[model samples]
Target: MRVVIALDSFKGSIGAAAACAALAQGWLAERPADEVLLRPMADGGEGTLDAVAAALPEARRMPVTVTGPAGRPVEASWLLLPDGTGVVELASTSGIELLAGELRPWDASTRGFGEAIAAALDGGARRLVLGIGSSASTDGGVGVLSALGLRFFGADGAPIPDGGRGLPEIVRTDAGSLRLPPSGGVTVLTDVRNPLLGPTGAAAVYGPQKGVRDVARAEAGLARVAEEAPQIDPSTPGAGAAGGTGFALLAWGARLVPGADEVAALVGLDASIAEASLVITGEGSFDPQSSAGKVPGFVREAAERAGIPAAIVAGRITGDADVSGFAAALSLSELAGSPAASLADPTRWLRAAGARLAAYRTQDE
Candidate 1:
């Protein structure tokens, strides 16, 4: 039987590729005669670039140094696929985790992400794939736009400051020096669908996580940006992603696509699953959000569509998550007897989960 194993990163623990390898190791130990395929996955968040690099053997990593979320220099890298498609991830450039638990809601910036994109363009990337999840700023993407030569000016024609605090002073935009998108254009990947402003939007919904104690101020700033650029629709789905980075990219002529679906297609997941006897998918946590544009949920749905039994292995299966769709489900946390123990050595637990699942499959067969 052919078994396909695809899993997202276990967050702060093991990455998707490592987790998949560990699981495959255990599965093969029990079912040595079975064919196993590994396909690491992500939803355009923290581990996006790693996932893509793992899936595409010919992809190259280009190093870059740019402004971090907290206005510090950060060393990061973007991916260049064999097809001349450059992949830039915001999480590695201007993500919140880079701040080391010191959130910067008001002054964080996405300038680093833009710098990485510019580097990719300079390196002759024919197309761009940007993963904008896990952003650390609410600057309405001004920092990124600025890096790409889209100037934001105040009433005196002086350049506005960087970050969310600068948004309220924007009076006009000048794209005079902006670099045009390549022939293949740009695709922005994100799982979020919230608009740029309002109760369900960027500031109101996500600001708190970034340490924005005054949501009203952030909202006003984003609103001002929208007003100045009426040509760009603030109400567009995903416009609020990465603290309005989606809005800026849209203004720069990029289209927003669902992160998981796009990554799946890039990895040819459907084709892989069609020939598989069983499919196993996983993530760090199996929660309500897992079913909403996340990798494991997408993999499971694909398996269901192909009339194949799908199993799931997660770091922890949350109480409210719906797992009825999966043919078999296992939690590393449960297998290890505690969340702490499971996380202490995720690969070990992942392997055990894989072995148990393989045993269960054998009994069913």
Candidate 2:
């Protein structure tokens, strides 16, 4: 039997590579002769950089010091692929997890990620892959644009403050000092397809997740930016990704693509699924949200489309998750007794879950 394992990181508990390795070990323990392949997966979120770097061994990690989301100095890293493609993930520097305390929806910035992008450009990278997921800011990516030489001015022509709080004050902007990639173009990878403003857009749909209580303010801020720049299509799909980071990048001439689909293509997931007898995928949480562009959801869908058996191994499987695409599912939290323990040591439980799946067809039956 041939099996392919493609799993996203378990977040704080484990990375994509480690999770795939542990799962493979457990599956091999039960089916020693079965062919198993591991494919790391991400949706432009937390593990995007790690997944990309793991997939490409020749990628170099270039470090740059930049401002963190909370206005602190932090040394962050971006990937420089052997093909002169630079990979930048927003979660590394401006992610929500970096916030130690309360979420600063009004003050968080993507300035750090912007710095990384600038460094990659300075290093002569022509093609850029930007993973704009799991951001901490509701600033509509003004901070990022500012870092790239786009100047925002208020009614008095003064520089706008950082974060969403400054968006409303912006009356004008200019990109006179902007620099373009080496004509290879920039690709913005994201899972979200929400627009830049209104109810289903960036602020209303994602603000609450970032500890924001006033969705109206965030919406207004993004709207203000859109109003200032009529050329930016606020209603475009994916404009809401990364707290309107997609919108900002689009204004700067970046193309938005589905992160999981792009990553899967880059890693040859479609071919792997077709060649495998069983396809397995997973994530930290398999919930309603996972039904979208998340790894487990689309991976299972792809396997089903290819007429292959598909299963999922998630850290926690919510009861309401749409698991119709999967033939079976397993949860580390259930296998390890509790969510706390499962998270504290995901490797052991992930292996156990994998073995359990390996033995699912047998089980002394």
List residue ranges in candidate 1 displaced over 4 A.
Answer: none
CA displacement after TM-score superposition, residue 133 of candidate 1 (Å) = 0.5
What are the root-mean-square deviations of the candidates from the true structure over C-alphas?
1.1, 1.8
Candidate 2's error at 240, in angstroms?
1.2
Task: Predict model 1's lDDT versus the native.
Answer: 0.92
Q: Candidate 2 lDDT (Cα, whole model)?
A: 0.87
Determine which window of 10 residues in candidate 2 has minimal summed lDDT. 356-365
What is the per-residue lDDT of model 2 for residues 1-365, given as tens digits with 9 covering 90 to 100? 88999999887789898999899999999989899988899989888888877777878999888899998987789998888888888998888888876699888898888888998999878899999998999888888888888889999989988888888788888878866655799999998899998889988999888877889878888998888668888999999988898998998889999899888876778898888988989999889999788888788888878999889899999999888778788989899999999999898998898899989945644
For model 2, what is the alpha-carbon lDDT of residue 357?
90
lDDT of 1 by residue, 120-228 (tens): 9999899999999999999999888899999999988999888898788788888899889888999999989999999989999999989999999999999998886
